[model samples]
Target: MVGCDDQMERLLEDLTQYSGSSRERKFIRIIGMRGIGKTTLAKKVYNKADIRSHFDFRAWAIASSQHNVKKILISLLRSPKGDTFYIEDEADLADMVQKSLKGKRYLIVLDDIWSTKAWDDMRLCFSSENNGSRILLTTYNSEVACSVGTENLSL
Candidate 1:
């Protein structure tokens, strides 16, 4: 993180900012070329002590080129005991995630997201309740970053 102090600060501010009126779930997109510290920055922000304390639940999933919605959901919904809950249906898994996270402040990090379809699929697992939840996405594609309609941190 030699030259990433500024970007790290920006991400921390974005992650912690709040508005009294609208506590809707927000997306913080990190866009840059491959191997340009996108994932590294996201990891640093996600692992901060204050960040861990701020959210009721935090999950991390890697969405590489061959992203699978079910797999991603499993990663998000895994228990602290390292037990992987098995569910054959994707919708059922997604429902479990939503039900567990409903009305709670959560942080979901989708690292290495390669396509808009991946975001579309994973976003469904989260409820858009005004609980100040957030999704931190790291992608190498500008198009995928812009599709979320949020401010992107270009690394």
Candidate 2:
């Protein structure tokens, strides 16, 4: 955690702020080259005691290079609740995710996203109803970070 205190504090401030007046959902992206500590920083924030108490639901998923929408949704869904059944259809899976996250304040960490398409595909499942929900991700590509349309921190 050396040299990461500042970054962690900044991210924590942004994440824990009140967004009650904003209609849009908040997203935080941590971008950096390989071997940097983007994932570590995200985990540190994700596991924080304040963060855990702030959000009603919390989920963590690894996007890696190959992004599987179903698997990601399943992981997200399972985090707040327990295990969920396997659904064959993509739409059904997405609908399930949306339903699960619908009125709850959630913090989802998407680690190692490799592409904008992956983010776009998964973003549909999260409903932005001015509920102060947040999606935080770590990525190697700056383009991917920018495409998320929110504050991005470079490590």
lDDT of each: 0.88, 0.87
Clashing pairs in 1: none
Q: Cα deviation of 59 in candidate 2 (Å)?
A: 0.7
**For residue 65, what is the lDDT in candidate 2?**
94
Best by TM-score: 1
Q: Write the per-residue lDDT of candidate 2 for residues 21-100, one digit (tens) a residue.
A: 67457898999999899998998999999999998889998998999988888888787668877688888988988888
| Clashes per candidate (backbone, < 3 Å) | 0, 0
Which stretch of 10 consecutive residues in model 1 shows the poorest summed lDDT?
A: 77-86
- Model 2 residue 62 lDDT score: 90
Please, what are the lDDT tens digits per residue for candidate 1 over residues 1-155?
A: 89889999989988888866778889999999999999989988999999999999898989899999889888888843366887999999899989989879999899999999998887777788888899999999877888887767999
The TM-score of predicted model 1 comes to 0.95
How well does candidate 1 score on lDDT at residue 30? 94
Which stretches of candidate 1 lie above 4 Å from their native place? 79-81
TM-score of each: 0.95, 0.93
lDDT of 1 at 89: 97
